[model samples]
Target: MLSTSMTSAVIPIRTVYGEASTGTSSQPMNGTVVHEQQVRTARSYQAALSDWKRWAADHAYALHTIQPEAWSSNGGSIAHDKFSDLDMLIPLLADKRIVYLGENSHGVAEFNLVKTRLIQYMHQTLGFNIVAFESGLGDAALAQGQIKMTATQETMMRSIFGVWWTKETKPLFEYMKETHKSESPLRLTGFDIQVQSPLFQNANWIPSNGLKDRALQAEQEVHKWRMSKDLSGFRKAKRELIKVYEELLQVVTKNENALKMDYPDEPHIVKLMKRALEDRIRVIQEFNELCIQSNILTEQEDYSASQSMMEWRDRAMASNLAWLATEIYPEENIIVWGHNGHISKAQSLISTMPKSMGELMSKELQQESYVMGLFMGEGQAAENTREPVQLDPIIPGSMEDILSAAGQPYTFMDLRYRENERGNSWIFERMIASYQVMMPMSLELRRHFDGVLLIKQVKMPTYLPHKVTKQIG
Candidate 1:
């Protein structure tokens, strides 16, 4: 018989959430500090089920995935097939106003498996709707707006189109187009940029009209920078050049009045001007340093750099949020797919504003709809071989290690490393390069959503030792 003390031993449910604050009690792992919300005791996995049920009911959402924290090489036997992917969450999410799909980490094949499954669910089960990516922001803007692409924007779009239309990303668009035509007619949005040739060509030449000679001279200074025989260095030069041109153009573009400008503003304007000038000088000095980081840049002088991509990401997020504010319906089901970084709470666009244009429009249009983020698991064993963690702090051992330590029984899965040179080459080095692109999208999830469901997995090896530590004196 179990003793009363043994039965009553408390197991604290420790939760680390993004919203927790730092510099306070019970600091959250993600830099936020939060007090322990509650304490509970459970005798078995079955008892813990009640806690999850209660959590789901209170939050109006269901989280379906085995926690890595639950896996212990010493604690018990773990099975390879123990975890559930998005397919398990689909039915639960059927009634949701919005479903956020965050990809697994870079170089993790399991994420692609999850993504494929989600796409299938969206097609066969959910039907068509808007499909957002971590990439494709510029093209999305062009598709939505009636205004002709500015020379700069057009170049940016073409560059992006060239990069993403390749083998790796082509299927995502094909899937979107096919599904859109059949079901809901999807819209595309992204927060990525193209950083290569043809698109970055000197297409935006200032007209040699009398007042713009300085602009032409600046462009020439940037062009001569190409002789360094390094594409990455030249990209820095181009970004600097573009910044200078934009500042110079701003002066010519906007007519100023003295009254609206504070006399103190003159000093501010001077500072701004000096900053722009100095930026170009800094770019020249840092050109050599930039070249060393160029392995990610294409061998061909064809691709663009992260600066333009980051700029485009901001514009895309702004535009998409604006569109959502108007067109999205309250209580209607919506699903958004993007990279892990883009949907995180800290940098996401949605979290930054309480009432975005999309939120306002959503309120006026949809009623009381909600948004949420799906934080995908990355850098864990089940995700990426390129990056791996030996232990989980909360659990204190590997999936195998924990089971061994605890003298528990478990099964393990066979995880194989598969690499597609054509398919995955660009994902880390080039694709999803800008953290700015990922941040805002994730923020919106944390801010606008009623609750979040994080998706992660653990891959257990097939072999395990019968004993972890033999106490041989």
Candidate 2:
């Protein structure tokens, strides 16, 4: 049995979040933090459920719900055939160049299984040909570069974070490996600029020993920044890494043709590499600033800085994702996988947060993209992969409560309906800040997601024994 002594979500008195926090706490694992006044703790849950049922039934969409059993993975089989219910998603999403699949938390078994199903569905049915993870841009790129001839499950597994290397996620890797030989096979890419995978030796963007050495140094320094209790050597590390990245930036600009020559078969390789380098520099700067103010600033000020630091990451991710969609895979539709906070659009207008990747792409792509957010009503989230724990019950009258009241174990709804429509239309206008099943925050649901997928009860993932080098949420 899971421990009841722990919480599904961690609600601190007032804590700031950094990427390394790797938790749904210190703010939240996925989206913006929720303050007491920002959340409406009283709502008519039964009425909302009845109204939602009425809306879904009027539309004749399978109760607009798919039972969890229908979405299950094949037991130890490479073929994940639980796709009969996934066709329901086709019409709900926009026919766009990119569709972002955002998860509330990464470590849930159901979230990974369901999302893997969606990725496969979108790839085969909707022609979203690339699956870009929220991992190292270069690492995933190099990993993909090896996919056709020299790759294994381990190659793809190494490309992503440790949280995803699970039994639930194995089929996706198997599918990727199996399909690489087929015509127009699905491919992989990534948008994050951070270096997580230790594949720096394979970098071919530049032949500079200095650049390669600097990236390794930066990776080590970043490790120190995350692991060091005293945050020792940060200032000096920041200065050296920034100097190296800046100097390398000048070289990359000067030798753009060399990079193009290095990847003559790929489109926009030079620019993508440049953006990867640029974001690395900026992210370091942002992280450095956030860390400095973290200890010295007042509670609110620290929160603001921490949020901005995250936003900077969102901006960087947006830039790289745009390049992936428009330049790298110009002829192919793409699917992006990331955290809901990074994918949420509501941050654009919120004074408390900066523009998120969702907002950035919404502005850039106009009607050419769809961003979806995932949530869970109850049960265990493996955000802490080592020891699975239950998420706290959602606040009684919060929006999650209202959404959870739908008469199904799993439910999906498109957020395209006009807010002015009567009966359950309050959903569009309703502000719901979700850390999946954590403390509720405030944001108009319609503004944050084009659609939502809710699994009423979720189970934590079974972690891989040897693959996980360290713990992550």
Candidate 3:
């Protein structure tokens, strides 16, 4: 990270289909020029895509050899050196403090493999040791606290969503185990506020139950609001929760040493105590946003996963990420794993929805953070344990089509730009970049992500077998 550039060990024999390394723009990409870019995106689409193949041939980073590792019999890596194709991105992302590696969904097989490779690169080369996942913050923290350094599969699965425990990601788990024995260690944590169970309310962590009693009553009130939207009751509960939380935070800040005596055997006792408190606060903050959402959508008969609900969740996530970056690991660099929708600076096509987490972080962290969105041309898509669906061919002029035309199985492009010069319309034009619903984000394509990594074709993730999951849990 100290330097922006690193030469790839194996460069392509010839630059085929935009396989050459090229910089798109010198000016920094930010919100200041979003309105201007949106106007530029209105340029003739046909003109932009006519030379798509030429642009792709000249700009795409062709990558077909970057595959997942092959494991040996004794938990050793039989896999060779890899991801040289990614060296081109070193300069674009090296200076970033927090890099969000995001997926269109939780289901792509190849996405996991490539992400693991990226994680390794970040850890070994860029000095990023912490990875904050979109999982339960308290659950992951408490699970990791029990381990000395390396974590077991079950412990990890228990903490995060099932999307991460796939066969493709098993190597990452093993890598964590291996690195723990060395001078460099890749530590895993979660930034999400939601937890499987209520945290820090038991007698083990808190000597007195005054805070716990107040928290339980607040929880009950929340449940009541869920069953029946009693806004007044919920308001009372939220106020009480905030009051009690402030008191607990004050005590922890004032007397962390005195509290540590209660957890004599715990290794990360201090972090555990503070993280548990943070978890509760996140839940409260989430509910606080939800209150706004409830005002908007609760009156409707069918309020199932409304856009407003998603907006509130994104707001909560942004808040948690800010806490993680500024408070939890101020000096250490971190990588974030989550969905493309959460990490993109692009606004939702529906103007009414709240701003996304990526947009918020873009404003908060500015150039210090980088977001890269993953997409594919043709592929099988699935959620965890669900049947895979064959993806329709790429839309004629979509970003995927242009990239796949590079004739390579994988390609990458940085969307940052100087000005909307002609022939690069595809980069600036209002086009769908993903295979899913292709909801228009109103902004120019370049604003959606700092850069994009393309997979020509992909298969659905190989979900971990039930027995494997059971054992891990």
- lDDT score, candidate 1: 0.34
Model 2 whole-model lDDT (C-alpha atoms): 0.64
Residue range 146-244, candidate 3, lDDT tens digits: 434335676566557776678887777677655655665666777665444344534345545777676556544443444445555656567667677
Candidate 2: the clashing residue pairs are: 8-390, 8-391, 8-392, 24-29
lDDT of each: 0.34, 0.64, 0.63
Task: Quickly count the clashes in candidate 2.
Answer: 4
Error of 2 at 377 (Å): 1.6
Total backbone clashes of candidate 1, pairs 3 or more residues apart or in separate chains: 49
Q: Arrange candidates by TM-score, highest first: which order?
A: 2, 3, 1
Better of 2 and 3 by TM-score: 2
Regions of candidate 3 where Cα sits further than 4 Å from its true position: 1-48, 69-81, 149-151, 197-272, 275-282, 285-308, 348-350, 362-364, 384-387, 417-419, 435-443, 465-473
Worst 10 residues of 1 by lDDT: 464-473
Poorly placed runs, candidate 2 (over 4 Å)? 1-49, 56-84, 149-151, 202-215, 226-239, 242-274, 295-301, 348-353, 394-406, 431-433, 466-473
Model 1 residue 420 distance off true place after TM-score fit, in angstroms: 45
Give the Å error, residue 179, model 1: 4.2
